[model samples]
Target: MDISINYTRGQDDPKSGPVKVGWVVSDVEAPVIYDPPRRVNSRDARREHGKSASRCPAVLGLESRYFEIACPFDINIGFDRDKDGRPHLRNLAGTSGPIRASTLGKRLSITNEAEWRYPDRPIIQLKLPYIFLADEPTYITQLDAYLHYRKTPLPGTIFGGRFPINLWPRPLMWAFEWHDVSKPITLRRGDPLFYCQFEFDNPERSVQLIEASMTPELKSYLEHISSAVNYVNQTFSLFDAAKRVRPQTLITPARS
Candidate 1:
């Protein structure tokens, strides 16, 4: 089955825009490295196999479908002292044009920052060129900063949201924690700042919390292995008695 998200371009958006919304090519340049060179030595067969073994199947599953959202403009963000001597965030400069950064109660707003503006918070908003419309429910999440962009850590935490196509009409906000009062950071144009993966929601199923009763056998087992040291020594020892019978396999499985 073919699945797709519909996008409506903003009236003022350029035809040759640098930022992309949905699926994108892997070769695009970004500040972060998502998939690093797994193989260290191409000639060493053992080392090459070891690297392949270390890859996480879950990461590989979503890698190709992950949507990378890039920075629309070149901008600098820095810290400065307010009137009360407390630290605050300020927008230094932007290459694309004048960017506005303002505070909306507890949350900081970045406005004129993008092509499309939100109705409520016009002061600080990301103007996404395309308003994403899906046939079903979808989710958008930020890329892992520690894993991908370790050198240039995001000053704030990334926020994710679940959107139901028919009910939710507004685009997602590019929210961050914005509490780091340390050094300044710069995001160049076309920098891969955000990443998102989508899933189709099942309306038939609703989330619910239910109390679970433990079985007598499970309770007895838990009571018997309550001691941390004893449990580790008996069952989770680094050198186990089972290993003596048949050594664990360290080799990577050969590709089929």
Candidate 2:
């Protein structure tokens, strides 16, 4: 099943072709360390170490993919201290070098091409190369932004929330909020700040939850599991015990 994503390029969009947007799995390189190290000599620790060494296929299974939205240009977001003593957040971008609020009205003709104002909050806005338009029966929600996983520290925090998308006539713009209004937040060009996840939402589909008693096969399996001294050893050693099931022959089907 293929879902199409249509978009319109902004007039000041520097890129020549359509924006490259696709599915991406969570960055597994971003390690999740457990608090209070597991006991080195414990049975649980040994099991965990074995799983970790094997690359834990069950844990690495992909249930969902994040949509990466990159920043088009270098933008400096901060309050205009030169203008007034009062704090006011603003976004400025330049054509050549690093963009700042002081250099807004100086060199570049600041056009509203690669940016748009939110209907509710005029102060908070987003900059992008193009506007997306999708008529499919799909829903998109904001996932954790990529800034969280970046090694470099951000000057300011990114603000985002969940929003459903359908066959809306207007284009979809990335939402942003500057946590530090007094200080400047510079997001370099091609930096991925917006992360989202998409799911098919069929209105016609009905879902219901139900519970049932275990079958005889399931009961027998549970009895065997209860009798086992080590669960992992019993489960994973099946191929070696019977010589029938091969790990190399096991295949998991691709999800849409």
RMSD of each: 23.2, 24.5
Worst ten in a row by lDDT for model 1: 203-212
Model 1 alpha-carbon drift over 4 Å, by segment = 1-58, 81-89, 93-127, 139-147, 201-256
lDDT of each model, Cα atoms only? 0.39, 0.37
In every candidate, how many clashes are there? 8, 0
Pairs with steric clashes in candidate 2: none
- Segments of candidate 2 deviating more than 4 angstroms: 1-64, 81-123, 129-135, 146-148, 155-157, 161-164, 202-256
- Candidate 2, position 228, lDDT: 38
TM-score, model 1 to reference: 0.42
TM-score of 2: 0.40
What's model 1's lDDT at 28?
26
